[model samples]
Target: MNFFYFAYGSNMLALRLQKRCPSAVFVESATAEGYAVNFSKLGRDASGKGALFEKQKSTALGVVFEIAKSDLKSLDKAEGVWFGYDRRTDFEVVTNSGETIETTTYLPPKMDIQLQPFGWYLALVVAGAIENGLPQDYINKLKSTPYQIDENQNRPSRLDALETLKSTGHSNWQDLFTSPRAS
Candidate 1:
């Protein structure tokens, strides 16, 4: 059995998603109604990660990925599903082509935390959004999202991800960084 996973945040990046599910294939660009992306999940990297924020009249833009059932556990582990994000198959997404697909989405069990995403983390998101050619206005909104510099130069994970962006044709996230909150 295969599963449809709607990736709205970092998973929007092909490279990042590839690392998690080698067999994963992009189905299409899709949107979930009445939801918005929220940087409310506290990550092990000491930065905030994206979660779905429910509100009326808001929709989130994302990509649909088809993953093999066998790879679900690995994908779950990569997403901290058993710990941080709670996986739910309750959501539905509509493709730009107007097809509605039932799929899985993740959110924090609790969303009380409000924190800015690390610059590198936010960069991963922006890179994915641009690579997938999500709406320009949505990309602008992503670019405008607030972020922080994870200055602990010793963080290999952060550095490694930034490095991986090169393969995706994105220069260093910080080097090209521009935040509306900054200026």
Candidate 2:
């Protein structure tokens, strides 16, 4: 069986998704019309609470990927869908090609996410924002987002991690992993 997933958050970081599902195929760029993507209250964990992706009626750009049935469960776990998200077949047509697909979009079932403009999860939201052509001002807001404290100190926002890299003068994290360091 084939499943279509609409990735609006960090999943736009292709490498991240590739790690989760090696066979995942990128289909095309699409948008969720009448909806806007925001990182808001997701849930709490030992590390810290997080802001998850939420869709409002303002349209957000996204990518669709085809995943194998065997990989869906793993992907769900990686996404923390086990807690905040409930997989559903209620997805609608967002493609100009008139293709209807069902996708696993994460949402809050209990309460609406109260928007925190500088939340830590904004870093994870960056990949999606950049892909969707969100304005530079918004991008800067994401880049400068401040970390929040939950129950733990280890669960800093993605921006905080990136800032740590910047402070350590290792601004290029991609290079740290992808490049051979000086011997």
Q: After superposition, how far is residue 8 of candidate 2 from its true place, in Å?
A: 1.1
Clashes of each: 0, 6
Per-candidate RMSD, Å: 2.6, 7.7
Clashing pairs for predicted structure model 1, backbone only: none
Residue 182's lDDT in candidate 1: 28
Q: Where does candidate 1 have its weakest 10-residue lDDT segment? A: 174-183
Backbone clashes in model 2, listed as residue pairs: 34-57, 34-58, 35-56, 35-58, 35-59, 36-56
- Scored by lDDT, model 2 comes in at 0.56
Candidate 1 per-residue C-alpha lDDT over 147-173 given as tens digits, one digit per residue, 9 for 90 to 100 = 888988879878777776877877767
> For each candidate, what TM-score against the reference?
0.92, 0.62
Q: How far is candidate 2 from the true structure (C-alpha RMSD, Å)?
A: 7.7
Runs in model 1 lying further than 4 Å from the true structure:
179-183
Winning candidate number (TM-score): 1
